[model samples]
Target: MLTAAIVAILVTMVLALIRAFLGPTEYDRMLAANAFGTKTVLLIALAGHALSWHSFLDVALLYAMVNFIGTIAVMRFFEYGNTRDNEGSGSTP
Candidate 1:
């Protein structure tokens, strides 16, 4: 049962990767990437269960945190133009 679930998740991850590659807009790509990250977390958790390793959950939690932070950074970068030159540029007020 668990093996089947893991396989399904892997399939979803592959589809998400395809979407990330073929997305027409940056936001669409980001969304697909985020979905892949989320599925990765699930995959890790399932693998940990299948292998009887308790440490994988911790790794998954850390991955989730890092993924969330990266998504935020990407969104901010798109919104603010650039992290280093957002304040001093004379494009607008």
Candidate 2:
């Protein structure tokens, strides 16, 4: 059962990678990257169980946090980091 889950996740991850590459917009690509990260965490947990690795869950959790934070950061940058509007003001501050 675990092996089957792992294979399914791997397949989904492949699809996510394709979406990341071919997505029509930045948001779509970011969403695909986030989905890929989520699947990786699931894969880690299942593989850890199947292989009897006791500490893998902790690593997976940490990876999950990092992925979430990174996605948020990128989204924020996309939303707020564009300085082109400020460039026209000619104010040096």
Q: State which candidate has the highest TM-score.
A: 2
Q: Which residue runs does candidate 2 get wrong by more than 4 Å?
A: 84-93
* Residue 51 displacement (Å), model 1: 0.5
Per-residue lDDT of candidate 2, residues 1-93 (tens digit): 788899999999999999999999999999999999999999999999999999999999999999999999999988987788789999996
Per-prediction TM-score to the true structure, in the order listed: 0.87, 0.89
Q: Worst lDDT window (10 residues) for model 1?
A: 81-90
Q: State the TM-score for model 1.
A: 0.87
Which pairs of residues collide in model 1?
A: none
